[model samples]
Target: MEPAQLTAAVVSIVNTLRIILEYMQNRPKRRQHEDDFDEDVDTDVPESTGCGNWEIVVAVGLVDTVERQFWARQTSTDWWDRIVLQVWDDAQWLQNFRMLRPLSWNTVSYFPLPKMRADLTVEKRVAIALWKLATPDCYRSVRNQFGVGKSTVGAAVIQVASAIIGVLLLRVVTLGNVQVIVDGFAAMGFLNCGGVIDGTHIPILAPDHLPNQYVNHKGYFSMVLQALVDHKGRFTNINVGWLGKVHDTCIFRNSGPFEQLQEGTYFPDQKITIVDVDMPIVILGDPAYPWLLWLMKPYTGSLDSSKEQFNYRLSKCRMVVECAFGCLKAHWRCLLTRSDLSTTNIPIVISACCVLRNICESKGKMFMAGWEVEANRWHLILSTQTPG
Candidate 1:
């Protein structure tokens, strides 16, 4: 083959460059016209007037027109609009895919293109919808604030939440260290290690079920939530799916995390025990959990100060899980309320929140560590618990 053919096989670089040059030369140039056709368009049209191909072309043109009109009007926003616009322009959010070009509102195909100058991106639309759902504001209030269709708010929120959880948040953080802190105390000895591993009654709208499988102590509808955090108080693993009626021990047995742990390949430094391979793992909880291996309990029911101190210390260490859960709830208030979430979707939502939390915490670890040193010194003195 010729050198040209070999070069062609490698890349169409030369050909592409030539084509680009030709395109630049011949491409349509905008020539300002005194008037271009009718400035306005006809609204009424028969739906069946065009064939599929013609309809597609016309649809694309309509979308382009909407985008163009939306952006063109933004240049002349009044003082009030300008304030809102300027604030939106200055706001920052996490976006790693920064290579994409800035979207021209005039050219983008938003479902309902802004009739007025202003328009929102899909992300902002979703965020606002979620905020409304989390807040006490009515749909009309939200519609006025966001300048969107009142009827579309609920649908938009559900769609955005579904997409975020289903497509974005199902990924689990890779487990490492597999740190285990096991301590057994007197009287009613209990496991205060992995987590309380108990099912909290989270009532939801009852769904059509096969039997009484999902019914729990509260009698409404609920799911089991088993969380596992490390010594540093970060979640290593969390299982949430079982019905509220399911025993914590049963949830643990079926959690599959223990299976991985028994295989000696779950997390880094996780080892399998030879004897009692199927034994329930040690996790932090009150005396209610009987199956835990390394259990810790306070002294007798008597009001001894030393016993109170031990319980207080245990509570401090256990408080890590509560803090992580609280932060997750605070950031994504959607979780705090009863969700219309199905069993299939709940785990994804939970996982995605964890991922976002991990991403933020990991990014801010260095900045956090600086203030944390001073805080840690005071914590050591004040805390009944020994430093891990």
Candidate 2:
């Protein structure tokens, strides 16, 4: 073969191969995932690197301005409406519930990515956490609605819930200053009643790690939220870490109130004298709880006229706790829906809801409609006067 013919054939083969490679590289790929666009790019930005082109500089600047505008448009009213927090613009409820009494959005605004539209403030993140509890929207919905990542939505909920559980749980659900609850129960016609206990189920998805642990006798995945509510629908005590399969009796037995009652330290020296009997102060419970001196349960099976009347009165008062649970579930509709949180985090979420619910109860629901601007300086009411 001649030298010219050999060179031409080699050149033709190389050109054909290059064309096929280019076509393969440019072909459209199947959309496999929700966040495929977020594929990890080699965005290893050089520390001292500047924009190599004027177009890149203008694009980055334009994106940054748009992001700032979107974030600036975050309204507290949107939070209230979405979270069902029943608050208004700069409402006291938002301040009290999120535990950001003094911190405003200016103090908590996060510097967002260049092209990302909106970023959440600290207060908004807490509000989003509460909104996740109040609405049935999933993480994807939150991501789309807030212009954040799905993982960011989950992280926000967890972070805010942790804060609430740390700062507000002990303050609201405590034995130290619950004399108000005891007095309220006395007025409700239940003698010597300090609190009313009840159990509710929060629906959740069957856990992937241990599916059997989440299945209840009702044949669904859930967890128990055993709470002791006051006459005004405030949660004075709560225990919510147990699995759905666990019975109410088992949960009550392991609760802090039950442990206190067993040690005879719950409201010691506060016995009520009736019929020449020195009956210890007691918290009302349904038949699900074991009858004890400090824990009164309605009589099971049969009852005389006097016993029936007593049971009726106790049940009527105990319904206060049920109403409290109803109110909590009604406001936080997420509790009614199947939760996306893991089994370990489910308790944390419920605890956060309880804290928020107590905050609302403290600021009476009657004040929801006529939110007075001056009322924004609301403080926790503490009292030392015990029931005589």
Candidate 3:
């Protein structure tokens, strides 16, 4: 057969490149004014054009248009539908979005009309903040993804998170829900358990003002997210913003929850009799917490027959806090690493994580992944507890 006749059998790299060049030359250059989104998309073809020159220009234009459309869609007023729906599954996103409208107002509620910008919708603002908490990406990355300014992203994060914490704290963590919490522990065979308290260190970048103060005994810069998790992997009370250098017990002692317990305001006037001794409901804590009438801590090092049994039961119930931390951190992987947020704003971010965690739980969001890995940060108390 003639070479030209047999040419249908194959095409070499040079031929393919030639064909691509021919295709680009014929393929109409995307009209610069094809759409309103492409008003100023100037694709500069660098000097020294090769056979692939037109292809690069067309490819650049294509990327530019697609990216503009993507950012437009993401930054649209209907961000709940475009961005939030895409990030969180439809079921979970809609389930927890009831408060988005109400809480979103907090962002601009305090500002005067002159200061408020209508270009960014409340839904978009909240979505940006939620994205910051729900992923490990930096806020600047999130800003670029959504076509919003980085500073706007940071401000929206704190405002939206603070609003969420204020709105959800009472609804999710109040003592009014103590009975349900008690029932949760009872089912686990920990009698009269009120709450599970544990403190997890939230790693952070060194602070500008006081880097030394933020460094913990283990020699890492961090803040502590001291939580009072109830049974069923929910945080009932959270005391965040404490420096990692401080001990968990000391942080607990200064918390509002502890003040309530100490002042006899933690629980209503009621008593549950255990072992013939009438006592108010109490939290189940690890050794890092002081053992008090309102708290139960596991026995240290040596354990006798019954004391060993008591410690075992306590460990099982107290494990809920660890599980709770696992679930919380797993849902929001941002907490697993050192965040770029400044020391003053880190607590707001942590509080926001807790708030969203409860919202997911409150709306029956699924957590099939279940618990996160155990970090094994325990301050085991060496002092023995005398039997009641």
**TM-score to true structure, per model:** 0.48, 0.67, 0.67
Full ranking by lDDT: 3, 2, 1
**Per-residue lDDT of candidate 1, residues 167-199 (tens digit):** 434343434433443332111232324433333
Candidate 3 residue lDDT tens string, 80-113:
5565546655445433332343343443244222
How do the residues 1-388 of candidate 2 rate in per-residue lDDT, one tens digit apiece?
8999999999987876665555445545523443443421212322212323332433334334232111122223354446433534445544333323333232222323122225455656755565577666798766656555566668778887777787668887766555676677778778777778889877788777666776776667778999887778788789997887789999888888787777768765677799998887788888878778787888877789989988988988988887787667655656766788888899998998887777766655422332222221110110121111
lDDT of each model, Cα atoms only?
A: 0.46, 0.65, 0.68
On the 0 to 100 scale, the lDDT of residue 293 in model 3 is: 89
Give the root-mean-square deviation of each candidate in angstroms: 22.0, 12.9, 12.4
List runs of model 2 lying over 4 Å from the truth: 1-119, 176-178, 366-388
Give the TM-score comparing model 1 with the true structure, all chains together.
Answer: 0.48
> How many backbone clashes does every candidate have?
9, 0, 0
* Candidate rank order under TM-score: 3, 2, 1
- Model 3 poorest 10 in a row by lDDT: 379-388
